[model samples]
Target: MGGTRVRTRYGRFGGALAAVVAVLATLAPVSPPAHAAPAPSVAPDPFFTYAGSTPLRELAPGTVLKTRTLPYRVAGVPLPLRVVQIVFRTTDQQGRAVAGVTSVIKPLTGTTSRVISYQSFYDSLDPEHGPSRAIAGSTAPGAMAAHVETVLMAAFLLRGYAIVMADTEGPTADFAAGPEYGRVTLDSIRAALRTPATGIAPAAKVGLVGYSGGAIATNWAAVLAPSYAPDVDRRLVGAAEGGVLVRPAANLRYVDGSRIWAGVIPMAVVGVARGFGIDLMPYLSDEGRRIYARLEKAPIIEVLGAYPGLTWADLTQPAYADPASIPAFVRTVNQLNLGTRPNPTVPMFIGQGTGGQLEGTRGDRPGLGKGDGVMLAGDVRSLARKYCAGGVDVVHREYPLSHFTSVPLWLPDAIAWLGARFAGRPAPDNCASIPAGNPLTPLAPAR
Candidate 1:
């Protein structure tokens, strides 16, 4: 609650063998809904746009309700036949039936039957920000994130791997909602493998990859697979996530009063509230309400560096001097903590950036040792160790670069790691090599 805006650090590349190298500064960048093709000759998103009473609620989770052919765009223009969209029935975090979307991108050439799930880190509260809508829809604020993600996805495509992009945040766009993210992702993969029109094998190898916001979905899906989605889990080879936010509560402390990434605090607050039907207004000060209203529909680009030195003291009422002490906030954040969840069944490849001090501010926060601008690096290490202790095969890498700068360094590795998982070879683990990390402490049952 008293986080200070301190200097950031540098990170990325060759973790175990080398120290994190400080990278230079550059602040900066960060859904799905489908619209009709402008080309009069093309049809609308038939399945995604259809108004039918199929009773998605009655169907089992992961059931494919409808299918449609949507334009797979490179930037904003359409590239027909490359991507297929599916509307499926899935369950939410609370076990309620909900409808979700997933996009299946067929490769242009090459011959790998492997299919990979690329969870794009499009962190936003707007429904249009989902990958399903952004991949083919017109360019807007948050939709361009799909375009940026396409660069990494192209590598998998060129390697002949069909990619499945799920709206992990769900149709409701519940940002930071962990269980919902897992449910949507696993179910989307289920929809893709089961949908015959996509031409994917029902038993194809699968892997999950995500960074930053996307990592929330990827990590949860992996941890939830063994129990929540065993059918999908059996086929998953491994999961790779970078710049992961393992503990949301830890992250809140990590980002408070920061320079570039402090803006995410309000964005996360509104998201968790919308997802769980909680009212944060009661504890928030007038400034907090203003920040909430301003960021209600704003995208990641708007959230980055939006607020400089914005502390909880500035947003919440004097009575709520420590937001975590608020019962509802503590309970909800604990539910979102990845460390509280079970270990992943499949092998894992994790990369963390420990250069937040150089990236923006508040890197020297006492409890939040280091970070990658938006996520806490120490928390990532703790989660990785937790997985290893649970008998999971884990490979954790720490990058010595800031959040934005670490992208190029770990993305290619994530791709290659996923590739290895699909190759039928054994994975290497670093369980014995990892050092002890800070405990992932959850709020006590009572204050």
Candidate 2:
């Protein structure tokens, strides 16, 4: 009976998803023949760099550095989308001023009074893989994820909501650096509202939405907005996210030896090392070094299933077998933990999934129980509960699905939740009934 119900829900969701894809198909240009020429260079555009003599620190966060209007294209096919791309000033994980890029897509007909800051889950270690590059027609291997996400953006755009797609990974493509993702997202909103030509009014209300890699940016942006960008915080109606990563340390453990998600271990190590400017070369084994070199610029798609049954022991020296033994890693993951951050002031809708076995991941792993293959369900529940305890309105839902399979189910509900926030409806909460999960304690250094 349970399986029957699950299938029924997915069957309905499939129909809805098909409708969305149909709309996207109509808007997008037909693909070229199989004999078409190879894709263009995937190099980062020169406009991403700030060449101005004025220092980045001198400019305010979200200060527009450059702007250009272009037709939005997906997978190298031009669509009728008039997108405004902006290079704005934002800070990195180290709080150093840096240039960030965002693409603003206005509805064809609307008041532009409401905006959806849609952070793309373009999880990559290469700057060339950002959404701006994909929207500008780059068909890089990593940019394919961004291209596919256009359907979600189209859903909101069809509802007459302006969409602000920021390169949440920042200019350096710091894959899992949560704080940096948050700041970049907040600054993107600032840049969008400040840019008159984008048609987003200064007083426009904003809502945050994303899943997976995007959830990292969305949740971080929500928590950091009150302090990092109070001006932007006041404009936020709510945040809706799913498959969130609450504690990086916990997630590393959760996916350490999984069949599909194990590769993320190395990719994350590389990302954190790059984001924090930490040199971990001395601690890596020869095998680890090789994996690092190969995945230095890989996208999440490339890493998924590429290294099956990979483990931390395979990547680190015997002495540093435990990730906590590495001081720099301990510090980095602790800093990236969303549980340590302040609760978002606005209402939030959080979704998580538990059924890793569906994705070839074992559910039993000591402290960690079931998860959606990558992100731990307990960690997400704990984070949501913490927010609720802090007097934040939070609606948390757990699904009996894997990370990838849960998206179709979570997205429609998330979109509907955001729609309610925009409609001035009262935000709901399941905080009181949420089950107890893991303790979000910080990682302790190895003695």
Candidate 3:
């Protein structure tokens, strides 16, 4: 009788627990299995190619070459959202027509009237590492940056803002080629507006947002839009960027021998050569040549800190030790310098950091002053001041943070600033108080 009672009590308790679970299951449906399927291969996808009968040069910039829709995924895990990918014709750094790809992610609510051109800082020398591949479920190391950016993209999406992520590096992944980045970005927005699948109106008011490498694209797009794509420019609300690259030549000098950012020296070398179709191989030292060959197809993840204390002298032949001595480099970097370009017409919000020591980069460098590890804060200030002087509204902020850490602080303020712009608020400007910064003179070839 005792055993029977014990069994009966336990059975009743089990039945009650089962009933509770059933009710809870009804309230919250079960999600898909947590284990994601195998990631797609890292090999280049042929869909990126523009195989149409007409040459790319024959097509107008922003002309749509191809369009497809795919499920949005983050690091190989599929999300409920779907994204539209567009292949568009855009100009390269050398002014040649090239193919570019951009991914348009709509909010779950399906509102597409407001859009943000969220440039991805997926800095890589490999085209396969572009954002489109990551969105399509590739788990490659190079594509990881794009995968990580999906979280930030989701923030905009949650706010009922559609995000257009251009592979700003272009089809060839010309990392750090700022002009090409701008061209690709503007063209991507053009393509997104033209695509019916994206549901973005042709007259959608667009704002640009990016940090680090993305800032290169954001600022350039703003600068070039007035002439390169006036139709897109007129619709611009404003631009928000952090860690701006004002003058590439100064940056090259600033980051030389940096413990963390020195690797960017060779990456930029490879990217500039690829973007401009210039052959710099003859000027490289044997060690430089080996480093270049090894990093020709590397991503920024594999680069940072890989070559601590590397410098231009270490990378060039003895006679070409000074980068300015290389005629091609002088011409290319000057072209890449934001200071040489016309000021952007749109109101701008620029954020810069000055705590480079935290990232192993020294704060004291003659003429360069303090920087945010990779980008010089003073350079950013100079660019902002230049924009302000040109009658553009500018709001500049500085933080005692390194390049990576500054993002967390900059992002929230950037989003709020952009929101204010969209709401027709008067853009803010601190031009009168902005301190003088480093000179942004273009580099001249060494005599």
Candidate 4:
């Protein structure tokens, strides 16, 4: 379903949005008051914890847990912040801490603008296939957890913000897609609120941000907001998704023989099927099963070039031969193409980058609609207009950059847009009634 125009890798960190703040604090000398006694020497306790009988089940060994205070200046007014460590489970199945993979609690910060806001990030991981049926030494079970440490830590830290990246896929490395993703996202936010440091107002506001697979979580989080976490005082605010995979079925079809994604589809299939207890061998031919089983754990891009000897005609043959036998495949793909309707809880900010090719084809297409089918500017504009008409504050922007190039540019704007909502700004007008042209173009305020 996708192709990369540029190939650049990013790094992951263990709570280093910047250099260690405590270390910096220690290095800087402090002038004691004339009447003050000497400061006490203390040992460092990095684990962020609580003294309660009702223990949260997710906390595990080798995970670094700590609180981060986020301060942002708005119109010269200083804003106090609290980002507590709720719970972050490590991805190691040996029950040991794995380096560079973790999840934390993101808190609710009350806004001087009267809109309370909270944010979190979920990154993807890669699952591996081993020699035996009972695999061992697995670090993280799914792609959602695979490379997340690099993507999320870089994105959140640079913005002067802290995020709770929950390894919600559980200890078995289960990547709970769709509705399951929504549950974990909301529960983590709730857990963050319950942490003592958050100082949550009863009327605190909330919003979401995610990219690619993470966008799947963000989209469902927005849809489930009204029903699931109503007490959290959340509004959609705005959501900026990059290369969103909304239509799972369409994505599967596109990636079957597509360059750079051949491995991705099969990996997702085996991983998801295993998670759901579906056996794929019955649906695949002996040769098809053999190839899929071997390449299931391979990295996405690496898998594509492995089969170059095969023709496009060979790749599309399996799909055309049998459709009924792959019910799980059908269900999995169908989940990707979500329906069109406003979240009703808050406005949205949707965006797409021109860097990745969708459906194994590339071109500048207008009137491209939202969901997983196509990544066209025109469809995005049309969706933006619809959200605007329903009294949702919808803002759509297209950059000249590719998928990865636009992340840095999009992060700040996404954060600020949600920040405005947390500040209690009124949602912008509905776009449903707006003309298709310039749907994302900001209009002049009525005099």
lDDT of every model, 2 decimals: 0.77, 0.87, 0.86, 0.42
Error of 4 at 325 (Å): 6.6
Write model 1 residue lDDT over 85-198, tens digit each, in one string.
898888776667888889988654423368889888888887676777767764555666665676566667655678899888887788888889988999999999887767
Candidate 2 global lDDT: 0.87
- What is candidate 4's lDDT per residue for 38-64, written digit by digit as tens? 334333223322333433345532223
Off by over 4 Å in 4: 1-102, 105-162, 168-176, 197-203, 233-238, 286-288, 294-325, 340-344, 355-390, 429-447
Better of 2 and 4 by lDDT: 2
Q: Alpha-carbon error at 131 in model 4, in Å? A: 27
lDDT of 3 by residue, 107-219 (tens): 54555678999988888998888889888877676776765565655556666678899899988889898988999999999999999898787668999999999999999
| Superposition error at 239 for model 3 (Å) | 0.3
Q: Arrange candidates by lDDT, descending.
A: 2, 3, 1, 4
Find the 10 residues in a row with the least total lDDT in model 1.
Answer: 5-14
Instruction: Count the clashes in each prediction.
Output: 23, 0, 0, 40
Which one wins on TM-score?
2
Candidate 2 residue runs with Cα over 4 Å from true position? 1-43
Question: What is candidate 3's CA lDDT for residue 408?
Answer: 87
Which pairs in model 2 have colliding backbones? none
What is the Å distance of residue 301 in model 3 from its true position?
0.4
